[model samples]
Target: MQQFAGNSCSRQEMDELMQYVREAENDQLLHSALQQQWSSLQPEEPLYPVNWEGMYDTIVASPATENKVGLSPSPIPLIRRRWWAVAAILLVAAGGIWVWTKTPQQKTPPVIAAAKDIQPGSSGAVLTLADGSKVVLDSAANGNIATQANASITKRDGVISYGGKAPGVAANAPVGQPLMNTLTTPRGRQYKLVLPDGTTAWLNAASSIEYPVSFTGKERNVSVTGEVYFEVAAKSNAPFVVTTPQQQVTVLGTSFNMNAYTNESIARTTLLQGSVLVKIRNSQLKQSSYILEPGQQATGNAGGMLQVRDVHAEQFIAWTKGYFLFDHASVPDVMRQLERWYDIEVSYAGAVPQREFGGKLERNLPLSAVLKMLETSKVHCKVEGRHLTVLP
Candidate 1:
């Protein structure tokens, strides 16, 4: 307790302390004892900068407490015991050792003084009309932004939707080529879209999706890059098909997330609510496919066969829900996620650390706040300008 109060506890010690706290939270006697202790101690704000909410949530969602509870969308319950837990965190951070060390294993370079802090990403995207025109949704007004051949493009509360007939144009007059519109979310931003067929898509940062303004053919087809989550509107007559660089996913009105970033070695399609058939698009390999059910994920590479595995599907779509979840993720994997969302460059000082990270953090946290958490896990790094350097 004294070491924790002085912020001198190591990561393992902190883990043990957190375990004890979790036990107390569930035990009537320990709960009363902790509450009495809280009353005797004076509340003091942490002198060192700390992501209080992130720290609190991480502790409560630790594996010892709730194995996969962190992935759920349910809000954390508020109670009196939680207050004392937060107060204990503040006390820990108030100690001098919370300032961090210069050691290789726990180095935390002063980010604010050394460089500008990168703010978290927000809702933004670019809408490319068929005529080669573009509208920046971040700055565009919340109303009808453009008019296509058979649909009116409208932006409402940050969501771009295609609906309604163009003025002076008959809805059934489209006897020509279907107009296509592409929605792209640059790094440091994301956007949601409603397709002409009523299908909704949530595009992650550095992602793009192209589809027609109106569904004309027997199949509703759209090609994508990077990651996108879809809640396909039920259309029994027309199947919804998504084309990626490495695979094609065909669905009949279901919810799924596709991670097909060109930089990633493998493309993953996680099924959440409905069934999806994942087919390898690589020509060299014999055309093979796998059908994914809810709670299953299909993973394939450019030159490999599709493989199915059971997974906590919620983890794959956590970005759409505003959380970053790392389940036994490597250093490179975690850095890749940060690189896209924070719009920063990453370079290592030596061989990459072989450690695996597991936990959840809010996507809205600043870069420095995230780095601070990483340092606690003994993954040291330094930030300069828009670049992040992983130290040995």
Candidate 2:
């Protein structure tokens, strides 16, 4: 018998073992495997280092009726059900422990053995060069990728930086006929960039930023497609402008965040430092433009007035800091962030329930770990392959 405990296995080996667990109707085989795995990983020893006792106490006795493996049995003595429940719990815990420690190789398609249906995103993106060539930034060698005329674009320490004189920096020479370069983060990936003007941009998953290799004209301008947090370089003569689908934001030597996902109703611009002018073009905005102060957020587009409200700045830019900050965020809102981060899709079987979440969760946790947290809130769900279905 292959022992998964303390022994690593390839994805295919894990698949065979998991299939055995799922299909084995023989109680003897199941008991042998369960006992062997359990003896190796002492459940009584504690799952977490410091909080083992707390977790142990939390694992209350499951009702006899709770047969997690879909076992059919007649109404028997109370003692049998209680013991069955304990066995089921130990089997599950041991299996999860084994699966948690194993990871598939990079090129192989990963499978979720026990709990996590999806894994967290990492630093990756696609860099489209000026000459219509595409470079997979995640796999590319980290160094000087390609030079664009006078400026050089280099990848170092997981960030792409632009070096060399821009339109009005260092040498006063004209940076003629600027070539455009765009950095895009596909679903389940993210990246950072330092523009030619020394401004830094952190792009969220499913987001992109396109700009000239060199700062041009009186005002440095760039266009964005999704969410991006920016630390604009201070250029009094050449202000920085970020143009999105529904609105445009103008800033000078400041930091801010813009969330303009096409599926979202409102396009929001939150200012964390300095000042910014948000111009809304949607019909929802009665007033077209408003100046945002630090710690203020401008919400509403064409159909509404540029409404400015106070917000926790960190919550808006938490993704840049490697965390999901959910302060009374709705379930749909939470799932949308998860969808992009894990590169999965979510759907509801019926009318979506109204749910709000408030807390800070690490983005690095496996999908199962995160979902287990959600179960406490009564958000029952299941992940089949890459799709997550919300249960009533």
Candidate 3:
């Protein structure tokens, strides 16, 4: 009797053996070959079997041929033993295929799910008056509140109204007094106010708007550090001026939006409804000025260089209308707007792709939904709590 060793049977050898068994027409010869292979197997050792249950069983159970030489009365046990061997062989083949085709599992970085649905222009900043007074204007509020000089300060229907009037003189009043006020908005808050000159201003989140009680000079100037939209009252004799870190905007009764956040290097002045003159610092001697007509924008860098270009007026003023409208804007630009509106932090984990996106976003939606929309256009974003990371 020839003995069969498990270790000596290579995959090629087993395949050849299976082919031989499949080709045998004599049942006695097939049974004798199988018994010899099985008897040689050590009791404590494992054996690999080929898969032949379906076709092999059908063939073994069929009527025998007339030329059967050493055929036995029963081949059921032989078929059963062969079935186990076939199963083992098939499992080994499957495992080899799996090993070759399987890919390594991907490792996903951790992400925070909070504030995943914050929309673009849903919230804004608030102004805390000098007397530790608070005024909520993101939504509707009640009746007339106070009067400042020539302005009637009223909080009716969720808006702060400042109707222009002449400054009243009180008996024995101090002359040339400066009544100071501070406008502050916490995270997830927003507010709007009408200045004494009938100019309308909207403040963004985590921002402040400081103004004097009255506009006394030939030029009315106000300073800001975050984002604000202004619709100046037309006063040709007294031009309205907006002062920021890099440049100043002078307008004669025009509407514009200014983004002058200290953390940002460039200050932007976008004209919406009128003309304005943009003057960069240190360029005063050269008299370098960019005159922006309606639907134009002037961008001033920290080095006092100004660039003027045409733009969509609606895109610039969309924040005041409770949305963010982007027309092929960059990733950093989009992130900056998100940080201000959501009052969150942003960091980049990988190289930021040089891609531009164009869309309009309502601030009332979830932050996750906003990021999902951005992802549809090759820009992937992940949120970790208040921190957002952009990936290329």
Candidate 4:
């Protein structure tokens, strides 16, 4: 079995083993043997890692005179549902290799079994008050979490809001240096906020937004790190301004998604509705600014010119909707997202796969299930604790 797993078996030996797997159901002796072997297996990990691609190629290349053997052809007739399970077990017991073909109904176990399974991230965040007090919102009951600057702070339906306006407060109300608060989400958490001016913001995992508890003077200004989606309330006199590490987006009333994580090479501001002006931070000498209409995006880097292009704006905000929508995204791009949401560290064992993925996956699935989905595209990985190492 170890020799077979290591691809040391002769062609004839491999062919006979595949044939045995294909016909294991009709042969009761083979079925019982496979079942006994599977049931007697211990919880210990496998001694040798299976070469999945090699084993699959060998099986498909075998000259089967009676039935076509590849997964795509599906020439062999499936006699019973239990037969598929038995055949998969037989393949694993014989060669330590198992391939999922067209059984969509069957639940796929993790590709690499671990002692503990990592769950998905949930809705949560930490709120830093103006006085430097921290409130863990997830564990707090869902109402009147705190009060700040004469504004009632409430958490309800997974959204934190600054309710109750300071009586007689006007857009041009005189204010001091302005009390600021920050809402931050950890790697394994997300959060939503309703700013004092009624603007809504959704913070993705490992992101944050710092804003005053109340809008004052001529404009409402905020700074953010990481990714955030916003629906700015319309106030002609008080334009909403969002400042990131690389750029600043100013709009009277607009919906947009901003991705400005420090690790990312480019800072992006994608506009969904209304108009926004994107300007490079401290680019006074160069003087760069771009006006983005709906369905347009502005991308720039530090000390670089801002570039605007058309895009499907909805795709950028899909994370706020509880799923990842990857449109021809590279492996590193996909893994970066997974790293934040699952709070897992990803490293490469060899050359990174120059592969692109396009699909929509739920954000609520376990890390293992998500990895299994990636395996369908031949992306393999080994998970140990909270670390996932991509394998070539």
**Judged by TM-score, which candidate is best?**
1
lDDT, candidates in the order shown: 0.75, 0.71, 0.60, 0.74
**Which stretches of model 1 miss by more than 4 angstroms?**
1-115, 165-176, 283-287
When summed lDDT is taken over every stretch of 10 residues in candidate 2, the lowest stretch is: 96-105
In candidate 3, stretches whose alpha carbon ends up further than 4 angstroms from where it belongs are 1-124, 131-141, 144-152, 163-175, 282-287
RMSD of each: 6.2, 14.4, 23.8, 10.9
For every model shown, what is its TM-score relative to the native structure?
0.76, 0.69, 0.62, 0.70
Write candidate 4's Cα lDDT for 132-200 as tens digits.
999999899988988775888999989998876663243454645667789999999999999999999
What local lDDT does model 4 show for residue 367? 84
Ranking by lDDT: 1, 4, 2, 3
lDDT of 1 by residue, 1-392 (tens): 55544345665665575556555345565556555544544445432354666665654554422432122233445664465455435443433112222222334442222334789999999999887999999999999999886578899999988877543233464665577789999999999999988899999999999988888678999999999999999998999999998889999989999999988889999999989888988646654688888999988876678788998888898899898876767789989999999999999988786556666667887887677656554566878888998877
* Model 1 accuracy (lDDT, Cα): 0.75
Scored by lDDT, the top model is: 1
